[model samples]
Target: MTSIKTKKILSKAGYYIFVSLLAFAMCYPLIWMLCSSFKETNTIFATATSLIPDPFVLKNYPNGWKGFGGISFATFFKNSGFVTVLSTIGIVASSTVTAYGFARIRFPGSKIWFSCMLLSMMIPFQVLMVPQYMMFNLFGWTGTYLPLIVPSFFINGFGIFLTVQFIKGIPRDLDEAAKIDGCSTYTIFLRIIVPLIVPAMVTNGIFAFIGKWDDFMSALLYLNKPQQYTLALALKLFCDPSSTSDWGAMFAMAILSLIPVFLIFAFFQKYLVEGISASGLKG
Candidate 1:
């Protein structure tokens, strides 16, 4: 019995050690970057093999924040924040309503519409990129944030799919009970379905925020002016082929760029698990 207990303890310790090593392997690049962000610019690559920045230089943050072409990173951050926040809100609100309609309402052609929405998820974005660009250009929205923000309000196929699956997991009896209690469909959605799907909505919000925040392609396609550039696009400007790229400054800003994504995930992480599980996903 003592031998069996000892073996079990050994097995658990081995498992933990293996997981810790795997996690460290995955995070080594990030740790290296973080350490490099504090190193002197010229010595960054010279001492690249080292994980600890000797005498920890602190100028990278200020230099990177100075930005390019007389424009600071503050502007880039503001532009990104504006676009990401608005786009996220639009996607969550529109997707929630669309999912509710598809999941709860029984109208003619509902299945057909839902099938089309699902089909959209399979289509590559590259196929639609050109046509979308032309349409926006014709509407005179190409140079504006309209192209970035407006489209998000219309539809989000993944968001709809996720919320629909989650809503399906909910007992229909509660909806029926609400109806019997003189609740209109709108009221039922507002009071009952919405509250119940908070986890799903949070999951959707996190996805939307991250997608929009990291939307370099969309911003590159639409925005022509420096003032309108988002953080992702602005990062590209830091690389000047004509001159030496400030690797240290770039790394500093890159680290700053990661903070929002990290914070959002950190705060809403529980909802992600709950939402996935509630949507009937399994390991």
Candidate 2:
């Protein structure tokens, strides 16, 4: 019995060690980027395998923040924050209402409409990009943030579907009780269904924030001015393969750009996992 227990303990230790090694392997690139950010640009490529910076310099942060075309990194941060916050709010608000309507209300062609919405998700965004660009261009919104922000208010197929599934898991008895108390459909949705689907809303908001924050293609296509650029676009400015590049500054800014996303996920990961799992199960 003692020998068997000893074997089990050894197996567990081996498993944990293997997992730790695997995790480190997966994380090595990020680790190397962080380490290289402190080293001088010339030394970055020379010490590719080294995780420790022999002569670390703090100039990368200041230099990167200085930015190209006289636009600072601060502008990019502010732009990203504005877009992300608004887009998140819009998605959660619109999707919750739409999801509530689909999940609870019985209207003509409701199932057909919902089916169509779900079907739209399978269609790749690239296929629609050209037509969308042309439409926005006709509206004279190509040079502004409207092209990026406005569409979010209309509909997000995934957000609506996620929320509808979660809302369906809610007990219908609550809606009945609210109605018997003379509550209108909107009131019942606000008072009963909205409160119950907080997890799904949060999940949608997190996804929206991440998507908007990391959005490069839309910004690239619509935004022509330097002041309108996002963090992703600003990072691209660090690279000019046609000429000299500031590798150190680029790495530093890249590391800094990841901080917000990392913190958000670290703090709200439980809600994300819980929301997705619960909604998926209900569906």
Report the Cα lDDT for candidate 2. 0.91
Clashes of each: 0, 0
Q: What's the C-alpha lDDT at position 208 in model 1? A: 94
For each candidate in the order shown, give its overall lDDT on alpha carbons: 0.93, 0.91
lDDT for 53 in candidate 2 is 90
The TM-score obtained by model 2 is 0.96
Candidate 1 least-lDDT 10 residues: 274-283
- For model 2, how does the per-residue alpha-carbon lDDT over 115-191 read when each residue is reduced to its tens digit? 99999889898999999999999999999998888888979999999999999898898889988999999899888
Off by over 4 Å in 2: none
Give TM-scores for every candidate, taking all chains together and pairing residue i with residue i. Answer: 0.96, 0.96
